[model samples]
Target: MNLSAAPAIEVQNLRRSYGDHVVLDDVSLTVPQASVYALLGPNGAGKTTLVSTLATLLHPDSGSARVAGHDVVREADAVRGAIGVTGQLSAVDDLLTGTENLRLMADLLHLPKAEGRRRASELLDRFGLADSADRTAATYSGGMTRKLDLAMTLVGGPSVIFLDEPSTGLDPRSRRELWDIVREIVADGTTILLTTQYLEEADQLADTVGVLDGGRIVAEGTPAELKRRVPGGHVRVGVADAVELDAATRVFPDAVRDDATLSARIPSADDLVSVRDVLGRLEDAGITSASVTVETPDLDEVFLSLTQPAAPSRTASTAKELS
Candidate 1:
């Protein structure tokens, strides 16, 4: 991603409400060019609402947003021209064949007949649906249907794409295949804004993650950076014998030892300095055969901690302080 370039999507204190109920409250975020930014939250956390506002489908009640360098409210047409949206529900027409679907989307974008046919053929091959291009959408499996839906979104060749729960119902293998496709899209310089309930998906795909709760972005950072903010991180050291275990325990007095596994679990901040210190102490104690591994809280833990009811409002500075 080009850090020096203007962000593909930028929001400043964007807010939206439905009568007395606020769906998005003072939400602000930036999605870097040609990168994936994942929005994670509970069922009513406004992930979809945020995406809708950015896609120019819903007008924000307050604040401002720019998508693909065009204001979502003022330059709605320009924003629409530069982006594509694949919503939670599949946009594929069940009665249409795979190739017909792409061609239909191409036609809607005003491409010429020959160009529409070319794009349809190319998209069918690119998404591995060429073999079933003639089959109706109803005949395709869950995975194939989802692939076709995404392919239709790309028919316009948009610079920024919004995927709202794109992998909601697929099996594990299908989900992984979709992840690979998303990676390929980003590699080709497309910026993506994705919303998902799957914590692992965000960890695997996002360059940055924003945890929305109570209609606010409570935390935002890279997957690794957010994981480091949660506590309970430790280093596990395995020893060959009881003698070595005893020596290692002496070196780390506060470590939790397990006789059954002959390992010592030493508390750590999950940082390089703490890991280097542990290894240096083991070497000094002549425990040369020890095997070490660092363990830190995963995204699940980070999500739960940051979205707690009493969790304070967090800025980038607050996130660093927690880390």
Candidate 2:
């Protein structure tokens, strides 16, 4: 994750349209080297279109996209060489064993025969599929199938990986395990561009998040920064009695008080130092609160605020392609 180097992925003024229906509109963003960047959007928000264009699967009508320093169009082969893609659906062949699947990917990558075998073995072990390596992929569980699919993406040792909703249907435990795997990948200095349905997944794994809406990135920043952009942050102080509550309210004149809950909600940025300052000032005024809690807007709130207004009524068809 060297910030000194050039970015791994960059797009500028990208636009794509299908029969006069615009899917991507003036989209632009950059993904730093060896970091995880998550692109989030509701159905029809053009997330998949962006990923496709960047991966060199689709051509943009106008504008430019580059991956791993190679232009996706003029240098498609170089861009392809530097990247691996794991799409929303599992790419595993049902009849092949987990070991066979890895071997297949290695063969596709044109690795030497002996090297392919070694690489397959390493991936089987790395993805925890060693025990079931010889078993057909058809019988593998959802989590196992996902791991095998992701492992296949790594057969070429790509510097940049595109994961398009890689954990879409996994259970909670499986999802967390996938997140752990993502962390490991970025730690090895591999940049990843992930498109996911899970907001919590972005919050947990992304160093930077881009919120796409109406065929463009509506917002892009660190999770905390985006959350801070939305309003909802405050500190709630619960006092022991009405006397303490009244004293705290006077100090925080703008606070909203709730007599029934014996609490006062003071609008704040919710940073640690600010929260501590509020508590210290209350203590100096000889008012001790029963409890103090800080609440900030979460990704759900940010997502809602940013996309809800522009979101179209989604359908099964919209989920598959850009609007």
Candidate 3:
């Protein structure tokens, strides 16, 4: 959040092209340390390209990016040393046991043998894989496999992590479970740059959100700030009959009246004070509404409004495409 401090991830006018097609065009962003920054785009709005570029998996055609204070292109080794990446698919070996997977990561990190064993044990317990530590990943549930994959990523104690659609095919329960794990990771001061298609996931986790579309970042802000930009919040009041409906409309002159449902859709921010204020006015006017429902502009609405006409679509293959 502090502008003066070096960002965990920073990019300026980043451009990437494949053959004759542009995959990323003048993309720029900054992710603060110890915060979760979500890059939201439909299926293929160049989210993967952006992440891969930041992770030093791909070099930009122009501009510059830094990860953990190291230039992604110039100091790629340092950037790699400070970051971890979990792509859409589980990277764990199906034949390897849970403990073996973590051990493999530890070995790749070049940790001492004794330290590798200790780290693997800790990760198995931390990710709730202790009971299944000896079980082959082939027999693990979808959620378990994901946890192990993420645990493997953390074996090196990275300062920044990149997650590309971490919850792609997960069930709702599994997704929520992964969300909790993500929260815990951030709480530990590991900055994360996550690319996800789930609007709710970004809404729930991001300290800042960048909406990417057609290889460009169209919007950027906190979840609440983005929602406020699109005017959609309202309160709907249902009344008994024409008389009550008429009374409601008179009280709320700008309300959109519904004759069939005997309801009035009143323009409101859908906050507590606003809801109470509306109800108080209706009460003062001696108008009784049979039911009241509050609705607000969510990420879905903002996403649709911003990435439209040219909705998120797959572009040509980048240096590393998520298959």
Model 3, 1-323: lDDT tens per residue?
65448889989999998987787978889998999999998875789888888888888999999889989999999999999999673579999999899888888889999999999999888888899999999999988898899998899999999999998889999899899999999999999999998899999999999988767777888997677666586788888889988888998897899999889888763333266777788888887555777666888988887774443344423212311
Question: What lDDT would each prediction earn against the true structure?
Answer: 0.87, 0.85, 0.85
The digit string of per-residue lDDT tens for model 1 on 1-323 reads 55449999999999899997777878899998999999998786788899999989899999999999999999999999999888674579989999989998998999999999999999899999999999999999999999999999999899999999989889999899999999999999999999998899999999999988777888788997787666666789999999999999999897899999999888764443266777889999999878898787888888877774434353333433332
What CA root-mean-square deviation does each model show from the true structure? 4.2, 4.6, 5.6
The digit string of per-residue lDDT tens for model 2 on 114-226 reads 99999999988888889999999999999899989999989999999999988888998988888888899999999999997678989999999998877777778898777
Error of 2 at 39 (Å): 1.0
The CA root-mean-square deviation of candidate 1, after full C-alpha superposition on the true structure, stands at 4.2
Flag clash pairs in model 2: none
Query: What are the models' TM-scores?
Result: 0.84, 0.85, 0.79
Task: At residue 166, give the lDDT of candidate 1.
Answer: 88
Rank by TM-score, descending? Answer: 2, 1, 3
Candidate that scores best on TM-score: 2
- What does candidate 3 score on TM? 0.79
Candidate 1 residue spans exceeding 4 A from truth: 1-4, 237-264, 269-274, 280-291, 309-323
lDDT of 1: 0.87
